[model samples]
Target: MPTVLVTGASRGLGREFVRQYAAAGWQVIACARNPDTMGDLASDSTVLQKLDLLDPATITALANALVDRPIDILLNNAGTMGSQSFAKHGLNVQRFGQSDYADWEHLFQVNVLGPMRMAEAFVEHVAASKRKVIVTLTSMVGSMATNAAGGLYAYRSSKAAANAIMKSMSIDLAARGIIATPIHPGWAKTEMGGPNAPLNPVDAVAGVRRVIDGLTPEKAGRFWQFDGTEMPW
Candidate 1:
């Protein structure tokens, strides 16, 4: 069975990924800040690990613990949109003239720096696997060519930085036969997407899994939507 290390496995898309992958007989390293919160998702095929993207020590510890393991896929799925609730306040808190440096810093820590740290720590594990792939869940709001509304400054910028990191990783890790890319999960009806969003977490995650299933060397370093469309930079 192929092994996958997934970050932010407590809820939302991360939880869904765990469910789908485990059901398909994959060995899943499901990581979350609080493993207890994973609840009934625990199974014989899943190993829950405590992980906090904000803390480098936790990341290093997990990487060290799994040093001998070969991870087929390193899924950087943990991220943040700041303290404000998008469901209630919408993008008002992230709008122009409302920028909070502290919140912005937190966003960058989780969305941008976290994935970079994960890639650096787990490069060996991925390279040693038969299917070496690194996937970061980014957003289309990060796309410079697609930006029109221009509101979510912090969240948008952090995802944009993440996209850049994935692109560079694809080039840098090519010698190791690792395929790295950023994928947009779309506006799903999750805690961040608000209740009115069209896509549900099940379908959204399913679509992303399809995209990951089809990843190839030629497809690395590009932005992709959940529906398999190539997104603009």
Candidate 2:
């Protein structure tokens, strides 16, 4: 069976990814800030691990523990939209003149730096696998061409940086047969997406899985939506 290492598997899309992949018989290394919070994700094929994207030590430790394993997919799915609750405050907290440098720094740590660190630590595991792939869950708000409203400054910039990192990884790791790309999961009704959002976690994750399933060398380094449409970077 193919092995997939997924970060942020405690809840939301990450949890859904764990469910889907485990159901399909993949060996899942599910990483969360608190492994105990991954409720019911445990199975014979699923290994729950503790991970905190903000801490480099935890990342390195996990990589070392799984050193001998060839991970077919390295799913960098952990991210943040700062401390603001989009469900209650909407985009007001992240709007112009309301920029919080601390929050922005936290967002960059999780959204941008975390994936870069993961890629660096796990590159060998991915390259050794039969179906080598690295996927980062970015957002449409990150797209320069798609930005019209322009309110989520921190979140948007972090994701954009993540896209750039994945692009570089795609180019640098091509010779190793690793396909690196960033994918947008759409406005799903998660805590970050708010209750008003149209897409549900289940369907959104399913779409993302299909996109990952279809990834190829020619398709690496591009921005893709959950529905399989390429987004402008």
Candidate 3:
């Protein structure tokens, strides 16, 4: 069976990805910052371990733990938004006024650096699988062309950075035959997405999975929307 690993598998899109992938008969390794609260997910025997992407030691340990195992798909799904840091006051309403650079740094830490680190640690394991694919969850907001109504400075920039890194990784890891792509999961209903989100999380996952299913090595390093359309960086 194909084995897939999803980071931030505790809740929201990450949790949904784990459920869907595991339900499809794939060996799902659901990872989260807190595995203690993830007892429900642990019911799946295939779930490998919980991981904290922000912690380098934990990352290395997780990689070491999976040393001989094959990981087919690696889903870099964990992320944080600046709103979670500065509270509700600082929005586009103020237009960058009172914006916290610290929040930006934290956002980049999770959204950009976290994915890059995870991929580096797990690339070898992914290569050993039948299907070697690394799917980094990016956002359409990362598209420079699509950022006409700019507001989410930190979140948008971090995701954009992730797209760039994932592209570079595709090129760098090509010799190992791994296919990597930065996929834009359209805004969906979730805690991160909020109630105003247009698409339901389940539908969004379905669309993204379809795009993932059809990807080829030629499609590697590309920025694609949930509908499988090429997105301009």
Compare the candidates by lDDT and give the number of the best one.
1
Comparing 2 with 3 on lDDT, the higher-scoring candidate is 2
Regions of candidate 3 where Cα sits further than 4 Å from its true position: 84-94
Please report the TM-score between candidate 2 and the true structure.
0.98
lDDT of 2 by residue, 1-233 (tens): 99999999988889999999999999999999999866688999999999999999999999999888999999999888988777777666688988899999999999999999999999999999999999999999899997878788898899999999999999999999999999999889887788998999999999999999999999999999999999999
lDDT of 3: 0.84
lDDT digits (tens) for residues 1-233 of candidate 1: 99999999998889999999999999999999999977788899999999999999999999999998999999999988988777677766588888899999999999999999999999999999999999999999899999877788999899999999999999999988999999999889888889988899999999999999999999999999999999999
Between prediction 1 and prediction 3, the one with superior lDDT is 1
Residue 48 error, candidate 2, Å: 0.2
Collision pairs in model 2: none
The candidate with the higher TM-score, 2 or 3, is 2
Error of 2 at 25 (Å): 0.9
Better of 1 and 3 by TM-score: 1
Sorting all predicted structures by TM-score, with the top scorer first, yields: 1, 2, 3
